[model samples]
Target chain A: DAGITQSPRHKVTETGTPVTLRCHQTENHRYMYWYRQDPGHGLRLIHYSYGVKDTDKGEVSDGYSVSRSKTEDFLLTLESATSSQTSVYFCAIRDSGRGGELFFGEGSRLTVL
Target chain B: GQQVMQIPQYQHVQEGEDFTTYCNSSTTLSNIQWYKQRPGGHPVFLIQLVKSGEVKKQKRLTFQFGEAKKNSSLHITATQTTDVGTYFCAGGPTGAQKLVFGQGTRLTINP
Candidate 1:
């Protein structure tokens, strides 16, 4: 198993509030991703970083922002929480190593009222 | 943006039965990957298929990529009670940095 951990394991915030989720990896992988999972929607990418200060937007990137100032930590923030943004957020990492397996963090469940 | 369509939305089978789900991409994909998420668990990597017409297997599960590189399938034999979860297929284009996951197929196994 890969060493990945997510902070704020669970959170509940009211609408229009700002929330930030943290993702930390012990392996120092070069690639990191943020995704959201909702019922019947599978997982949708929110943002990803290939290296420190190198980030890209994903399909559902609106209303969210990400920053990776270091190799082991990635941060995602929701500017103003909304009911539609309530979902389980996951942090995943993959690098050119050990047969191309993508490891995931336990995930953070967020609920916006 | 890339998209994948997976089906059937949900499936239920008795232990020892067979199960299968498919993923179809709207455009040609450079590679396809599979993931499984147990109840209340995060999505875990299952396998990745990078070549057209490629096939790979692990224990009772088999994965296949279509020759056109726009579709894939996963079949599980002799389903067990532990086979309950959602299976997702993700695809990425060549030189693409992010992966797009399908809607996923939820599986339920009965004893």
Candidate 2:
């Protein structure tokens, strides 16, 4: 149970609509990551931020964008939703002081129609 | 692109039976970590193995890292209903900040 919270725990949006999921953390960890979980595909990294305003794309960053303007909040945005994007999104913070173990949020379930 | 491949997408076993899952990586890994996710819950870290040919045990669960640093396995003894979940193996490549996760193996137990 990390001090991580994901806004909009569950969301359903129509195709081609703009959607954004927010992740907020109080742990003050330097690394934050956005991951999407799909059945049979495990968890795929979408984007990650090492510090304020510092971000990098992951393996499955296509059609998605992320912003980390502050150390406590990281945002993942899907400019136009698609059915293919429907999945459970999870936000995680890495404790670099340790062995880089990740503490994940409860997750946000998004359904695109 | 480093890839971690896990086998046996799903498994069904009766209570008290044993279960195992295997993971292989396309490249050498600096470390390997294991996580378990119960149904409808987020994944939780279980353990990590950093040395080649390393083996660690936690209660009834055992984790092994291959000698080549490119493979790992998790074995659980006497499975129970509480052991039902998806197990994922994530590999951290050398000098990489991110981990590449396998597809995961879902374990279902009949009590």
Compose the digit string of candidate 2's lDDT tens values, residues A1-113: 88999999999999999999999999999999999999999999999999999999999999999999999999999999999999999999997889988999999999999
Expressed as tens digits, the lDDT of each residue in A1-113 for candidate 1 is: 78899999999999999999999999989999999998888898999999999999888999999999999999999999999999999999988565455788999999999
lDDT of 2 by residue, B14-99 (tens): 99999999999999999999999999999999999999999999999999999999999999999989999999999878768788
User: Which of the CAPRI classes, incorrect, acceptable, medium or high, describes model 2?
Assistant: high
Q: After superposition, how far is residue B105 of candidate 2 from its true place, in Å?
A: 0.3
Best by TM-score: 2
**CAPRI tier of model 1:** high
Q: Clashing pairs in model 2?
A: none
DockQ for all candidate structures vs. native: 0.84, 0.89
- What lDDT is reached at residue A94 by model 2? 93
- Give each model's whole-structure lDDT: 0.93, 0.96
Estimate the Cα RMSD of every predicted model relative to the unseen true structure: 1.1, 0.7
Q: What is the lDDT of residue A67 in candidate 2?
A: 95
